[model samples]
Target: MIVAHWPPISATLCPKFSGHVNKPLKGLRSFTFNSSFSFKASFRCYCIKNENPNKISSEEGFSVLGSDIPWDSGSIWSTMAFYFFSLHIPFSFGGLSVVAQILHQPVIDPQTEALSILTLQTLELIGALLLLNYTAKPGYRFSVFRDVIINLGMSKRPQDRHAVGWSSPTAVNNPILKEILLSSNVSEIACILVYCIVTPLLEETVYRGFLLTSLASTMKWQQAVIITSAIFSAAHFSGENSLQLFIIGCVLGCSYCWTGSLSSSIVIHSLYNALTLTITLLS
Candidate 1:
C-alpha cells in the first residue's frame, strides 16, 4: 500500500469573533463603531505612550497598491480618468495600447495632470479669496489666515494620529458638500458659477469626488476617507511639505464624513486648498 499526501485546507481564513458584524474592520479589535459615535468614546491612543510594543503591529493602516473602487461598472468618464489614468506613464506609453486608437490618448499624462492640478489649485485659491470677501462673517478678513493656521492643526506641535483620525471624519459633514448637491439655497446661477466658472471642477472631481467614492467601496467608510485623504495629500509631494498636507488631508477626510456630500467636502476643500496655495504663492 502506498501512502498519499494531501494538501491542508484551513478554516481560519474567515474569523468568528465576539461583537463582530459584517462590517469593515472585521477582526480588528481597536476599531469600534456603534450606531452613533459620540465625542466621548473617541480618543487617540498612542501605543508608544502606553509602552505597548505590540500595538501598531498590524499592517492594515496604509494602502500602497490600490483601493476598492468599482472600476468595471462606473461611468465611462470615471473608468477612463481614475482607473486607466494610471496606466499611462509617458504620453507614448498610453498610445501603445489597442484602445488608444478609440480613446485618443487613452490616458492622462502625469505631467499634464500635475500642471492642471496646479492651475486649478491656483484658480480655486483666488476664487476662494473673492468668495470669502463676499461670504465671510463680519470682522472676518483674509488676515484671519493667521488664526486659521493657529486654531487648526498647523501649529508647531507634533502630528497626532488621534487628532488626524478625529479631524479626518469631517469630510462627511461639511457644509459645502450640501451646497452643490441638494441646496436650492443658492440659485442654479450660483451653483454653476462655483461648480464651473470659479471653482476648479477637475480637482474636486478627482480628489474628493472620484477618489473618495472609489475607496469607499473597498474600505469601511472611515478607512476609505482616511486613505483617500492621504493620497490626496501625498500626490502633491513636490511642495516639500508632505506632513502639513497629510494633516490637512485628515481634516478634509473628516469633513467629508460629517457632511456625506462630496460637494460640501469640495467646498471646504476648495477653500482650504486655495488658502494654502495663496500662502505658498506669497511665501
Candidate 2:
C-alpha cells in the first residue's frame, strides 16, 4: 500500500502503518497530520521529536505506503503540462532570449553555458515546487522533501532490500545516457550540478514522486507504472532516446514502488546521473 501526500517537493513520500501494530513498516520522513491525508490515522510517529531515543526507535520506520492517493489524474496532467512549459518555453523564446540579445553576451564555452542553463533550471525548480504545493493544497506546503531525506536510508544500511516492489508494477533521450559518455561536454560546474543534482531531484519529484503515485491510486501500481513511464518517455519526445527514456522511467518507477520511498528513487536517479556525467567527463 503506497500513500501520497504533501510535496516530497511535498514530493517526499509519506507512509502509513498497517492494521497490525506489532509489525513495523517501512516509513517515510515526518509529515504533519492534516485533513489533506486520506488515512485518518495519526502519523506523528514518523517524526523524530523531543521524545526519548526509546520512542524514536519504536516509531522510526512505520510505513504509510498503500492505496488512497488524494491527487486526481486530471490535476496531475495539468500540473505536468504547466511544469513542462515552464522548462521549455523560457529557453526557447522568452525573457532569457531578449535579455541575451540586449546584453550582447559573448559566445560562452560549454562550461559557462552550462552555468546559465543551471541558473534558469534552478529558478524553474523553485517555482515548480511552490506551484505544486500551492495549486495542490491552496496555501499549503507539505513536508515531503524533509520526509524523503529522512527515509533515504544509507545504501549500506542493514535494513536495505529490494527497491521498486509487488503491489507496484512500474526517458528520454534526445541522447541516451550511453551516448552522453562520449559527448565530452562536461562544461561548467553548473552542468554537473544540473545533471547530477538538480535534474535527479526535480524529475524524480515530478514523475516518480507525484505522477506515478497519483496514478497508482486508480489502478494496479504495476499498470500505473507503465502508463507513467510511457508518458514520461513521450515528454522527452520520440527522439533516439525514447526507448532508453522509457526503460529508465521503468527503473525509476520500480525503485520508488518497491521501496515505497521517494528517497530511494531520488538517490538512485542522482547517482546514475552522476555516473553518466563522470564517464562523459572522463571520456
In model 1, the runs with Cα more than 4 Å from the true position are 1-200, 277-283
Per-residue lDDT of candidate 2, residues 90-180 (tens digit): 5322434444555575333334344445665566556656655655542224654344335432111000001111010012121322232
Taking the tens digit of each residue's C-alpha lDDT, what string does model 1 give over 24-68? 333433334444323322222222335776665434433232443
TM-score versus the correct structure, for each prediction: 0.33, 0.58
Clashes of each: 25, 25
lDDT (CA) for every model shown? Answer: 0.38, 0.54
Show where candidate 2 strays beyond 4 Å: 1-65, 88-99, 138-140, 144-188
